[model samples]
Target chain A: MLGKFIAGKFLQYLIVIFLMLTLNFLLPRLMPGNPLVFLAGEDVGFMSSAEKEAILDKYGLNDSIIEQYGAYIKDIFTGDFGYSYQQKRPISELLMERLPWTMLLTGLGLVLSTIIGVMFGAISAWRRGTKTDANLLTVFMFLSAMPSFWVGMILVSIFSAQLGWLPVFGAESAWSNYSGIDRIIDIGKHLILPLATLILISVTSTFMIMRYSMLNVLGEDYIMMAKAKGVKEKVIKYKHAMRNALLPVATVFMLSLGFTLGGATVIETVFAYPGVGRLMFESVLSRDYPLIQATFLIITFSVVIANFLADLIYPLLDPKVGSRNG
Target chain B: MNTVLSVENLSTYFKTDKGIAKAVENVSFSLNKGEMLGLIGESGCGKTTVAQSILRLIEYPGKVVSGRVLLNGRDLIKASDKDLASMRWKEISVIPQSAMNALNPIFTIGDQIMESILIHENVSKREALKRTKTLLELVGIDGERWRSYPHEFSGGMKQRVAIAMALACNPKLVISDESTTGLDVLTQAQVIALIKNLQKKMDLSVILISHDLPMVTAICDKIAIMYAGNIVEWAPTEDILKNARHPYSQALLNASPDLGNPEKEVVSIPGSVPNLVNFPNSCRFHTRCPLAFDKCRQENPEFKEVRNGHYTACFLEGVGNHG
Candidate 1:
């Protein structure tokens, strides 16, 4: 039974990877203009008409869409994504440099926000209609409604400019030649604003969803039974009510984590942070198709993996979701 | 008979946005030790509310405004929250209405049972677990199935788990609020029989609340017929079934199917229950009572003792041959 479940989940992820790769190939082509023009530089108006055809031929754009698709698939299997049209460097190298920063920021943001959100949500539901719940709900509603970049800008103004507590921009100072721990600290210091923005944005929605779901769970018969059985109030909340409440909220949290990934691009761009979100934003503006494709593929795969983990953990959270164990 | 559980003038009200719901009012009854008393009432009649109020488990907006739930001479209504918590499951346990869904699905039946034991008793985990196995076997479930989740069990088995949990602490009383509801007939009979056996063995006083009149007649020693939050008839099971004094209780007796009463016409109570927000100043059952008179609408009937140990509430209590 376990084997069958594992096989099915693995198969679903395989299908997701296939579709994401296909979309990666198709989405960039739909963008107007061409990366070849960017490669031709600022003197494109004076270039000969024949020179344009030569550039297109060199990049394999001269081939039909079907032939290009086949070549794209073959290139993927052979670990070759070609060079970036605008950067004059390999697309893979650019992604490797930028991807890690985004991963760290997003991963940290998700962990912090989820912990904060779920705890507050549980407390809010446990004390429904209280002043604390009302205040938290109102604040979250406002935070979620505001865009991540705007929130990032506001945070930057208050903390960096007015308070002078943390750095406002970039992963690190350009003039600093610090090494090892010092450099890590510099980057960590810079990570606070954008990180806080994304965390606030992600936590607000998760808190609302968790709070609502927890209220419903608290109304279940088992919860009442727990109280009647003389179980401690805290035990009833965390063990029984929270255990069931988290099933729905966990799904929302995972989905929102993916959603937060998308928003990170705007916040990263705002802070001038070198991450996949920033890279993707700049690549889109410059029409750097290969870099954009790599970022899209990574983001899509991360979402798929997150959902797959959720599917695996669901049986642990709610015993009624019978898989192999039941 | 020593009085085990006594509820006097109990009134529980729910303060909702729309209005104040008088869920239970002037509800009074007492259970003798080792006696199985059935509380028979239809849905929305505040039977479950009465049970919850006794435990003081009623949540927000619902308050036990005025009541005295004397369990072995201690009024739980006046008790502190700390005292109530301590009293629960040590002296009184509850088998919830939706028994199948009462146990936590994530935990094994054994763990859920052991939780109550470990809480109210000074027992180690291993000791509690051993007791859990014994409790499970006592409820007719296999001791080996202790590690099984609630979903793995049939409806009857799940109810057995709840029963095992309720009995884990060995309280003096168990308020089983429709533990056999929504089960197949055979399963219901099995659950009922199990309860009977456990009561005798444990010397338990039980308040068996259900809408199943026939089942109550078969198992309970005394029966209390609740109508719109008031006990309309209180008598020994045989007497209530043979000749109930109240109109509503008479209607309930007629609703039951018996092979001997082939010509007896089954009559459902006419008119739905009145909104409990402002329960009547007169008889709560007067709206649906066929024998409702001018006096019945003018004044609420007191619970008068018509005979020894057979009490009823109706304006025509001693007037005529009503029941």
Candidate 2:
């Protein structure tokens, strides 16, 4: 039964990947204007029409739309994502270079926020009508309502500008000739503002979902049964109630991971962090079709895969889904 | 017959927006060791509230306003959180109304059983697992399904798992609240029979709460008929069936389907119970009582013994004088 479920989920992921890849090919090509002009900058006006045609033809942008699509799909299997117009480099190479920074920022942000959120959420739900629940819920509500990028900026204004506590720009220092742990520590210092901002924003969204879900789970009959069965408050809250409540939170967490990518776009721009989101932002403005398409494809793929992972992980937590009845 | 549970004038109320909703009021009963006592009532008659209040498991907006729930000589109603924590599942445990909802869905049957065993007893994981397997066996579920989750089990099997969890700590009193309602008829019989067999084998005292009269009578030696938060009558199962004197008990008996005599028309009591927020100051059952008189409409009858161990709270009989 579980095997069938896994197989079905895998097929669903494959279908999504196919549709998204097709969209990646067709979407940016539909936009007008050539990216070669932006890459050429001021020299574009001086160049003859024949020169423009040559540049377009060289990148295979002059090919028929169907041929381009076929090449796009074929190139994907070959691990090629075309070439960046501005960088004059492989789009795959460009993204791979920037991917690690974005991953470190988002991954650290997501993990820390999830832990903090689940703990606070469960506590708030347990306390329900108390002052602690009220205070934390109110603060998180305000934090959630504030735009995350703006929150990032506020942190920058306070910590970087006023307090002079942390750096405001880039993934790491170019000036410092340090290597190894010293360089890693420099990167960590630069990471604080962006990571903290993401953590604050993500925690609000996550805690609210968890708190509501925990409250509902706490009301379920089994919770009361646990109480009647002499289960300790700690055991009942964490093991029984939190276990059931975590299911909904897991789906939300996966979805939030997707949004954190989108948030990184705004955050990277604010911090000037060298990440794929920043690359995507810059490429979109320059209308770098290959780079834009590749970045978009990666974002879409991450989201779809995250949800697919949720589907796979959910049945492990809930045996009802592992059975044929599910 | 030594009294195992002695509840005196137990009253539980809910603080709703409207007013204090008396869910259970002036309800008193006693259970002897190794005896099954059924508290039978229709839905919303405060039977479940009585069960929750017994364990101090009443959630917010609900409170045990007044009462004494004595188990083995200690009053649980007055016990501290620390005392109650130790008392629960060790001294007294409850089998909830719906077996399907009572067991946590995420937990395996073995884990759920082991949880209670581990909680009230100082035992290792291996020992708890052994006990869980034994408890599952006691409930007639195959020991192999111990690691199976609650959702993996069928409704009957879930009920058995609940029974196993209830028995894990070997509590003195087991409160079974509508424990058979959610199952098929066959499973209901099996569960009741299981409870009966377990009760005898373990020397247990049970408060079997259900609306099904025949099902309750099958196992319960003593029975209490409740109406609108009041225990209208208390008697032996056979006495309540053969010589019930209160109007509500009579109506309750008539309403229940006669298994042997299918031709007899099942009589359903008229009018739902009044809104509990502002329950009638007089007899709570007078509105639905077929033989309600001026006295019943003006004054509530106090529960009193009319015959040896047979009690009723009705002014219709020449007993329970309101003045």
Candidate 3:
């Protein structure tokens, strides 16, 4: 049964990738602007008719849309994303350079949020109806409702400007040319504002979700059974109740992983971080079709993959889910 | 024989919006080693609450006021949280209702049982697993089936697994709270038989809490009937059925559907359980009692022994007979 579930999930991943690829190929073309106009700009007089035709032909812009789509599909299978007209570089290389920074920020943010959120949620639920729980829940509700960008601005204003504690923007030190530990420290310092903003905005919502889930699970007859069995409250919460409560949270986490990657575009731009979101923003402004298409494809693929993982994890958390397909 | 568990003057109430809703009032019972006591009551009569209170499992808004629950002479009500923790599962365990849901879906049955064993005993994984396998076999499941998850098992098998998990520590007392409520008749019988066989072999005391009087009558050595959070009558199983002195106990016997008397009509008690909030000031059961008198309306009855081993809380039983 376990082997079959894993194989099914693997197949699902492949299907998601295929769907994402199709979307990536189609969505960019649906937009208003033409690639040639964006690339050549208003200075079309610089090129002769022959040179212009040759440039169009070389880039496959002269081909019929169907033929171009077919060629795009074939190239995708060969791991070849087309060259960027604006940057004069392969789309793959551009993606490779910026992907790591986005991952670092979002990945670290998710991990920190999950840990803190689940812990606080469990504590609050355990102490339900108490002043501590009431205060914590109120704070969580307030934080979750606050906008991420607004929080970012406030954090930057206070932590960076007023306290002089950290840098407000960018991924690392631009002037020092530092590497290793110093570079990591500089990058860490630069990350504080965005990280705090993401954490503050996310932790409350996730904690609330976890708190509700924990409360519901704690009310299950089995929890009462555990208590009757004389199991300690700590063990009951951490072992029996929390494991059951985590099912919904796991699904939410998987969904959030996708949203965090694609959704952080505005946050990246605000922080001036050289992540994929920042790159996508720049690509849109520069009308760089190759860069835009590549970034969109990556984001779509990441989302699909995250959802696929979430689907796969459902059965592991709930045994009944395994029998659903069978 | 030494008493394995004792509960005295236990009263549990929930502070609701309306008022203090008494769930279990002045309820008391004792179980000797290797004895099986059946707690039978209508729905919402606090039978389950009595079982939960013994374990100190009652959650917030509900408080156990002025009670002494002693396990092997140690007062559980006065025991510290740490003391209670050490006593749980090691001394007393519970087979919870909804057997399938009781087992964590994420873990294998073996892992869950091993957790119970590990909590109380300092043993190696191999040793704990060996004991788990033995327990499964004892509960009439194949020892090899321990590796399987709960969803893999049928309802009866899942219930058996729960029983095995509860007995992992070989606790002195096992509280089965509606353990067979949702199972089919055949499965229910089989599970009860398995519990009976194991109880005898392990020499463990058990508090069997259920709404089905017939099932309890089949297995319990002693029986207690609860009505609106109080023990209306308590006696040896046969004595309670053959010569019930309490009006509530008589009503329950008449109400129970029995196979031997197919011609007899099913008699349901006239009224439902009284709402805990704003319950009658006198006897809580007086509003529903058929033989309630003027005295019963004005004053609550106190528990008094009607016979050497039989007790009832009712003013109708004549004050002189109580002694």
Candidate 4:
């Protein structure tokens, strides 16, 4: 029974992946403007028609739409995502260089937000109806409503320009003379503003969500049972209430991970950091078709994979879910 | 008889936005060692509130106004959180309603029981597991089922696991609050029987809270009927059925559907329980009581012992006593 259920869930993900890839292929073609024109630019008017046809033929754009799509799909299976016309480099190599930076910032942001948000949420729920809960809730509400870019700009203005405590833009080390510990210190200093901005804006939402979910779980009869059993209040909150509350948050966090990656495009550009979002922004300006397609494909695939993992994890986190399958 | 738990004039109220809601008003009772006391009432009659107050589990907005809960001569009303934590599970425990959802779904029954043991006692994991195995066996469940998750167990088995978890620390008193309310009839009988048998073997005092009068009468030595936050009548099980002094208790007994008396119509009370918020200043039950007279509306009746070991709070009963 368990094996069949597992296999059924795996089949569901396979179907989802197929649908996502089909959409990825179709949506870009449906959008107005030809990729060849966008990539070759208006300056190409000076060139001869034969020269343009040679360029198009070279890039496989001369083929029929169906034939081109079929070949593109075939290439995808072979680990080939084509070459960037603007960068004169493989799309995979560009993505490889930038993927680590995006992961480093967003991964750190997610971990920090979850820890601080859950801690605050649990404390606020435990002290419900108190002044502390009220004050903390008010602050989170304000922070959640505030736009991320505005918060980032303000933080840079105060901490970077005014205080002169950190560098304003770029992620490079400030002290060119220094190596080892000093270089690490400079990079850490540069990261403080962007990381803090991302974490501060995102943490409030997680805190509010976790607080609401925890409060609801705390009202369940199991919490009362724990209390009646004379379990410590801390145990009742953390072990029972918080653990149950984390189920919804885990799914939400997984969904948020995808959005966080896509949403950080503006934040990355603002900081001038060499991340996937920053690369995408630059690619759009230069009309790099291969780079754009590759970036979008990578992001779309990650999201689909993340959601699949979330679905698979639900049965493990909650036994009741698995029972339903049986 | 050795009295194990005594509640003296316990009054708990909630200060809501509307008004002061009197949840449990001047309720009093005592339980002797190895005795089962049944607390019966309709919804919103403050039966569960009384149990929660004893555990000091009432959170903000609900406060114990004036109460003395003496467990083996130690007053739980004024006890610190630390003191309550120490006494809980070790001396007094509770098997809450919704037994199926009470156990952590992620954990096995063995881990959940071991957690309780580890919390109050400093024991190794192997020792706790051994104790948990014995406890599972004691509750009529196979010890091999210890590794099973809560969702894997049936409703009756889940209740049994909850009972086993409650008895993990060998508490002197165990409170089961509507533990079998939502189970099937056969499951309910099995659970009640298991509790009765366990009570006898362990010599443990129990406070059984339920809406079913017949169920309570089956397992309880003493019974208390609460109406609008007040204990209107309390007496031994046999005396309550035979000579119930309070009109409410008489109404409740009359309302109980008896299988043997199929020819007779069931008698339900005329009105529902009074709202705690903005309740009339007069006797709370007067508005619902069929035998209430002018005197009942003029003043509230005090809980007074009218017969040997039987207490009732009603103007009609008071007048009968005086007459």
List DockQ for all candidates: 0.76, 0.74, 0.50, 0.62
Candidate with maximal DockQ: 1
Q: Pick the candidate with the highest TM-score.
A: 1
Give all TM-scores, in the order shown: 0.95, 0.92, 0.90, 0.93
Q: Over the stretch A164-239, how does candidate 1's per-residue lDDT look in tens digits?
A: 9999898888899999999999988998888888888878877987899899988889999888887888899888
Q: Predict model 4's lDDT versus the native.
A: 0.85
Estimate the TM-score for candidate 1. 0.95
Estimate how well candidate 3 is docked, as a DockQ score. Answer: 0.50
lDDT of 4 by residue, A1-326 (tens): 87787788788878877777777776656766666665577867787889889888998879898888898789788889889888888887888877877887777888899888988987888788899999999988898888888988998999888988888887666447768988778777877888888898889978988898889888887787778766787878778888889887887788877654543776787787777887878776766666777777878878877777776778888877867886
Where does model 1 sit among the CAPRI classes?
Answer: medium
Per-residue error for A52 in candidate 1, Å, reads 2.0
Candidate 1 chain B: worst 10 consecutive residues by lDDT? B258-267
Best by lDDT: 2
CA deviation > 4 Å runs, candidate 2: A1-12, A32-49, A258-263, A304-308, A323-326, B122-127, B293-298, B319-323
Q: What is the C-alpha lDDT of each candidate?
A: 0.85, 0.87, 0.85, 0.85
Error of 1 at A60 (Å): 1.6
Model 2 CA lDDT for position B276: 82
The sequence of per-residue lDDT tens digits that candidate 2 reaches over residues B1-323 is 89999988999999988999999999999999999999999899999999988898987788898889999999998999889999999989988788888888877878888888888889999999998898999899888789887877789888888888888999999999989887989989999999999999999999999998988887789999999899999999899888888888888888888889999899888888888897777899888877788998888898888889988888766745332
| RMSD of candidates 1 onward, in order | 2.1, 2.9, 3.5, 2.7
Q: Which stretches of candidate 3 lie over 4 Å from their true place?
A: A1-8, A33-37, A40-59, A85-89, A259-263, A285-288, A307-326, B121-125, B201-203, B319-323
